[model samples]
Target: MSLPLTRLLRKLLHVAAKPMRHAQGKDGYVIHAYRGYGSHSEAFLMGRIFRQPGSRSQLAPGAGRDLMDVGRRMLRWGKSGVEVEVALGDNRTTAITDRDGYFSVHLPLDEPLEHQGQWHTARITACPPKQPPVEGEAQVYLPPISTRLGVISDIDDTVMYTGVANKLKMLYRLFIESAERRTAFPGVAALYQALHEGDDGQQQRPLLYVSRGPWSIYEMLEVFFQHNRIPVGPILFLREWGLTLQRPLPRRSEDHKQALIEKMLGLYDEMQFLLIGDSGQHDPEVYAEVVRRYPGRICAIYIRQIGDSDSRKAELDRLGEELAALGCVMLLSTDSLDMAHHAHANGYIDAASVEMVRAEIEHQLADEPA
Candidate 1:
């Protein structure tokens, strides 16, 4: 569907769902705390306050259950203008939810956190009008000072087998399928694990995943990552697809991804980054822009080939050359093993870990439907 038509349909649906959203009882207000990230001196966390229909419950895997879960998630109404307090250790900060019911807390620490390279818990509380105060805990990852490289990845076709190039198929796979039924690319988990471990096989580098997906599907993606054994990062930078008159459709994918990458670069100024994405979308162009803007901060760029046409391949070849001149190597490959080999050659990952990635590839292939 065209952009305008999609926006119109969404507006219609929003209007239709207004009554259902208001029917959410007073007991349904809840705070959803997302995973956050920070350095020793500062922390950044975000979450949402929503009026949902019912409490979360576990359900058996089936098509009916999956569709129902998707429906419930989509129907959540964000409660805007609410104040949210987040406390980490002895430091505390508060942020008010915007019109979209999203809140972000940025806390500057008086005393630096320990350089343990692990996740810390933050307590979050929100008191919606006429409802009881809701409390939740969020996990914040603080990378060790010994960290060498940072990995920023695209989620759709880069890590998993979501047919993003095709809209109809992508929606079917996204909403109709259960998390257990979704598939990750072969060896992606092992490759990411090796990257997280770094060259010494013990270094604690940051692995950040970015997606153009909506925040409503955050829990589903988390479940998908856990099921595939992919290393979880501090946060999955996702977008909000709010249906408003000023902007009905989400931001352009390239803009969304580039802004997030720039944010990560700004946050980790001391750390060089590895950009992992697919050629199925505008990832190559977006990463190239990042390399051009911040030359030395990017160590390497890996573009997974997903149904690239000859024209797209030609465009990527040009981008690769441009990035190479800027001191960053861009590799366009068909499989994770190739990217693993490149990483090993560049001393980004341990040599022995290359074999581990290969073994994982073979194992994943064996489990696939032939």
Candidate 2:
């Protein structure tokens, strides 16, 4: 569809969704507190207030049910202008939801929090006009002072087989498939778990994910992570598919990812990051640019080889050479095990964890159809 027609349709949909919002408000509003992350003296949390129908129970997956669930998640209406209160460790702050019903809390600590290197709870409440206050808890990850490394990964082809290079197949899998039907890359779960556990197998390094996908698929991605036994991070920075007259299209993926990575670097200035992404898109170029901009902040870059282009390979090799000169190791490999071994060699993960990752890869390969 043309940009103008798409914008018109979205406007109509927004108008139709407004009535459903007030009607559902009879049942009260819900605060969807997404997982957040924090440092010793600062915490950042984000969530949305919505007048949902009621809580949804986990139901058996089927074609019709999956379609309906996707529709429901995508068509949710945000309750705008709602005041949200967030409390963490005796610190309280309030933020009003924007037109999209999203609110963020950036709480600076009066006294530095003692780092236990685990998830902390932040209470969130939203009292919509004349309605009972809805309550939820946001899980905020606080990396321990012992943390030596941080991990940032891409979700599409890096962690899962999303066929992003083929846009039609990518959209089909994204919109039509259930979480159960979605396939994660073999051994990715093990590799990520090891990375999260760190080299000593006791450290609590932070693992943050960045995706170019829309926020509408957040729940589905969570479900996919749980089903695949992947360690759930405190945050998955996703893009908003907003359509306005000033900008009919969403922000460029390269710009969106670069900005988020920069934000992550700034958020945890004490930690260096290991970047993981796939060669199916612009990950190598984007990561290389980040490495250049923030020299020595990135420890390493691992690019999963999903494409078979010799030119692309040469390009990545050149980028790898450039990164090496800046004190970063860039690896372009077709197997997750190779990345795992490299990480182990560089002291990013344990030696035993490399074996575990290898075993998982072998098992997944055996399970593949002949």
Candidate 3:
């Protein structure tokens, strides 16, 4: 038979072979497991319900049970939006399935700070088919550093605004497009070069960036930084997992980003930080939690107030107060370069380094033509 015919024949045989076998003896199932990073490194195991020839005998007579013969369980990992599900069974049950035989349900990991900002683990279990189902677990680590004086700002709107994230329509902005159109908000590039370049005799501490943009865009961002003569460190990004009809997405939240910061902190303990973020989502909240948990790991928090919105400013203020209580500076700006200049002039950045960065930013901008 042709390949198409063969596939159709196989599917037909698969269905025909099952007959009307209800969940009797067979008690096995399948699971699609995924782990989120950083504080969300929790695992949620989802399973389905089914019975085989021998299960009927195992079923106790007059046994009270779910009519659809299905049950689901969850585990806590301090992460959010972990969903799981069972294979296709019945419409009566809440379990939805696809032709490939799968299901999903969302479970969240409790916050780690609640437990002294320490680490925690979670496990989930379920039963299903010829083989017995097994339980799975995931771990969550403490948040990244909490205090800092030196700023680690991305060249993009944490400092410069290429206009990817709409100052007018923030909600409509997504990662890919945001990355493409990103230009430096006036003076922002200069500011980065200034602080990163430093004027004093010493080297400035590193400025780390963890972007949701695809790794493929690395060249563009890198060129922009180097062309502008901005000093920076490793630019962390995700490699394209591949295009799917379901819609492309970044790696799990807290997963890729939080992990990157956490690793950087481990590399330098005494170093405090000045975190910079655009008016985009999560950066403020994520930075807030990081500060709350790490305490002295961060020295300052700077959020660029891109578009006109009081809500984000209010949130940064609240977080700033908390940081202030811990003795950290909280700087919010509509422009990145201004903050960059502040970091440089304050003696937070060395004079020699400032000169280098300033030279670069000047050259890049000056060449842009009036």
Q: Considering every candidate listed, which one attains the maximal lDDT?
A: 1
lDDT of 1 at 140: 94
- Sliding window of 10 residues with minimal summed lDDT for model 1: 18-27
The lDDT of each candidate is 0.79, 0.79, 0.45
Could you give me the TM-score of model 2 versus the true structure? 0.84
Cα TM-score per model: 0.83, 0.84, 0.47
Worst 10 residues of 3 by lDDT: 72-81
lDDT tens digits by residue: candidate 2, 102-134: 998998867544446478888998978887788
Candidate 3: tens digits of C-alpha lDDT, residues 262-360: 655654565666677765656666776777767888766777776746876677677778777877677776644456556766666555544544565
Off by more than 4 A, model 1: 1-28, 52-76, 114-117, 130-132, 163-182
Question: Model 1, 52: alpha-carbon shift in Å?
Answer: 4.2
Q: Sort every candidate by TM-score, greatest first.
A: 2, 1, 3
Task: Supply candidate 2's per-residue lDDT for 315.
Answer: 83
Ranking by lDDT: 1, 2, 3
TM-score of 3: 0.47
Give candidate 3 misplaced runs (Cα > 4 Å): 1-151, 163-182, 199-201, 239-249, 252-255, 344-346, 350-370
